[model samples]
Target chain A: MTWSLPLRKFLLYAFIIIFGFVMLYPIIWLLASSLKPESLIFSEPGLWPSEFTLENYVKGWNAVGDVTFGLFFKNSFVISIIAVLGNLLTCSMAAFAFSRLDFPLKKVFFSCMLLTIMLPTHVTLVPQYAIFHNLGWINTILPLTVPKLLATDAFFIFLMVQFFRGIPKELDESAIIDGCGPFQIYSRIILPLAEPALLTTAIFTFIWTWDDFFSQLLYLNTVENFTVPLGLRLFLDSQGESLWGAVFAMSVLSLLPIMILFFLFQRQIVEGIATTGVKG
Target chain B: MRHIRKNTITAYLFLLPWLIGFFGLVLGPMVSSLYLSFTEYDLLTAPEWVGLQNFIEMFQDSNFWQSVRVTLGFVLIGVPGQLFFALFIALLLNKGLKGIGLYRTVYYIPSLLGGSVAIALLWKNIFGFEGIVNDFLAILGIEGRSWVSHPDYALYTLIILAVWQFGASMVIFLAGLKQIPGELYDASAVDGAGKFSQFKSITIPMLTPVILFNLVIELIKALQVFTPAYIVSEGTGGPSGSTLFYTLLLYQKGFSYFEMGYASAMAWILVLVLATLTALIFFSSKYWVHYENGGS
Candidate 1:
């Protein structure tokens, strides 16, 4: 038997709404919990708080010793921004060379770059840590940010290479006829045209750097240098009683930048994944 | 000849940063890490050659095997579960309803924040003794314990968390679903095939390539799961190491205990296992994975 279109539509929308609520309940609960007082947080499990308080936000800001939450936010921004710029410049340059220019040992280096994408980060973590320690880069943002500047993330290079390959080579030929060198072509034509890919790279790099906790935990010792993730961890570890309210409040604040970015660039973020899925 | 040489020089100049990074950062450390795996080194002292003792010790080490079991269990269980949820949601979204964008966004929010410390903390709280899960259980007249604190259930909670971040895979599947020609569906419908038959015969077979891709990605990611386990278990991998993922144990060894050599050995083992599994997936794809442009 054929069902009425509106009836089927209603069912589908109902299912979507219910599943969407289920998907979002924890985050909604988190936001609600952050607003509740410590005494009421556990007692009231609903998404709507019986009584709301901003004391947790006030306390969590200054919970860590002498290093307020603002410092952690600043540290995260500094690292993320540097990482975004680093990936855009360095990865694009590498991609440009591979996609546009011909050179000696080009095939060897291209294969090597592809191989590194499959190599997990943990396999190199120990020795890399030692190298950074020896170079006095440990405990500083240098170990984290400097690597990005060196185009160490093969994933971005690969991504840009795919995008760059899509751009017609005739554009390069025309630019060359105008006496434009490789650098000039890259700066003027490819860079401007690769805006979407660059934004995708920048957004992902920022979000990943901000979310990375393990490396930050390993390298940064002092609270003053801690990124948002590490600082949020400090909120849990420093207190014996475990300040759930403060923890929840700080956690909510930690996610603010990502949430804002997600909302602002929703299409780009989704498109990036879709493109990578199909092309990759 | 001079022009060719000049072009090579320019290309290398463009690749200067990557060349430096590959040689100085990646290659050097990787070689040294392999060497370190065969030595005994703490952060305080130089690595002294111990000749495969770390590997030998790994087999006998109870905790090592526990982590292996934990990681394998996670990968085996979590990957399929996550993929199923992804494909299911993708199928739902493929129906093409009104306001689908909002649903997609809501579903995707968790994945965007999946690896964050904040989400990990939220997970811990959500499953804690006085948390929402228990409160819901109580409403159903069933008593509940803190799922994360119990050894029997900690890993399952982690698996649930993994499945919750199914949005990325779902989007990939959605793309794949969209790629299937609409004419095929209409033709099948006209031929008296039901929705289920169409999905099974047409959708599933056509979607195998995307399924393979999602499986490999999900497997690798599930194996390397760290932040959630770290935060939920307070970095101890405890409640009797039930949540001690392989990467977490490696981190504790290398960073916390300063057993760099041992951790290096563990890391190498992980790399080999992942490589083999990826290779297996690639090899097995020849049997089942479909390509629209090619013969079976």
Candidate 2:
């Protein structure tokens, strides 16, 4: 609002740029190291590679099995997509029920659902893994994606509930007046209107599932079935001749989708995460 | 009551997925865990009725207390570091300066990828011997050990990793900042209040509810931290067992050592501890958390 404000503003931008570099340096360093030769991963440390190579990418991607890098990439992509779709669909539907619909015993049921969200997943991992073991779903991708379809994550449901609450009551009344049933209203009206919220949920689901290492560790036993994180861990664990460059390479590669997602959905991701924080 | 019938069916259908998951995946195992906690159950042998033996045995186990100490050390040390860093960066980002988006994006990127095994691996290199940190330290003629492998500082690397993910909480705080009426600061400024005074009097109280929310989630998340502790400790909670956070300890007990019953008891104790702490937070909310809509 004044002349001094411009000077302060300039200083602020300068400060932020420095801070941004500080934050991003590790990632940049990883990417750069991934390009360097294995012998030089920790041996040399500067801004760029003395000898740049894509061999680490090749090695890291194919690290899973005799399988091509494309197969594991496809596996990661497929699981994440299905999981995200399942989360967005089932959670939104549940949120609609809890927030907008007039239902019997709603308050009691809704509170119980919230209680589940409050409990940490690690607390139940042992028993749940035992249950899954008995049910014979241990080694398959089914355990990972199926519960997502079942809306196991209560946070997404709660997020969708908050978003649903934000929509004016008039839209629902108007849809009802037009003779749209609950499912129709959900499919045609609410789903279409709640696109941003759905994207938020889907993106969050995709990232969480993609980055989840512990579950992948517990569920996928075979190296061929390993998710990106599991495969990367294996790379880390191999003996003295372990390829640090390849591990770093695969790590950077795995972050590609998330980086792209953040860049594209930049505004909504921040806004959605923040909104839920405020509401909670 | 008549209209409620139609909506009830619809609600049940909508909630069918969650209900099934809750009952089958969560609640069923939850009750079973409690039952198992009271028994000496290994996967091979059926659960022998052990009464309170698991609980009594735990009282004698020093490792159990060691875990409590390590986990509490993590929560106590890491939570404040994470929250304070988040809040500070959040305040800086809330300045409405140009290119704040750029700052927000870069800062939040680490959190997006923080939990991945790759980051854990990267953390080893970044914080370990011959890592960037030691390299920097060496330039100043100071020697640093393999921080990730050594017991004295193994947990600090995990703490750094946890703090790196403060981007999530920071972004939340930025949102909280926006909700505070900018006019509050304007009035404070007009009243000749300095920034610290304004922050103390206006920003903190206004932001209390969000802080409380962040604190509760952070507390729970910190209590359950597993990945870094596992990876950095080389899957052993190693270099004298310095980094064995509670969840990792439970995982090792259950899967590694085949002590399912003991791990179940540990898991149930974790649940009770967290539940009690969260309830304590809820009870204390009336004192500090000032909801904008009003109400004690």
Task: Give the best candidate by lDDT.
Answer: 1
On residues A7-79, what C-alpha lDDT tens digit does candidate 1 reach at each position?
9888888988998998899998889988999888887657788888999999899998787999999999999
Candidate 2 RMSD to the correct structure: 2.7
TM-score of each: 0.97, 0.94
The regions of model 1 sitting more than 4 angstroms off are: A1-5, A239-242, A278-280
Q: Interface Cα RMSD per model, in Å?
A: 2.1, 2.6
lDDT of 1 by residue, B1-296 (tens): 99999989999988999999999889888998999999999967989999989999999999999999888888888889989998998899889876778878888888888889999988898898988999889999999999999999999889889989989988888888999999999999999999899989999999999999989888888888899999999999988999999999999999888999999999999999999999999999998988888945
lDDT of model 2, residue B97: 68
Q: Compute the DockQ of candidate 1.
A: 0.69
lDDT of 2 by residue, B161-207 (tens): 88878888999998888888878889889999998899899999998
Share of native interface contacts present in candidate 1: 0.78
Residue pairs in clash, model 1: none
Model 1, residue A47: C-alpha shift (Å): 1.8
Docking class of 2: medium
Evaluated against the true structure, the overall lDDT of model 2 is 0.83
lDDT of 2 by residue, A1-280 (tens): 4459778878877877887787788888988999998888878868699998998988877666576556666777888999998998889888988987877778987888888987877667767878778889988888899989999988888878887888887888898898988888888878888888888888888888888777887888876687777766776567787677778888888888888888888888888778775210
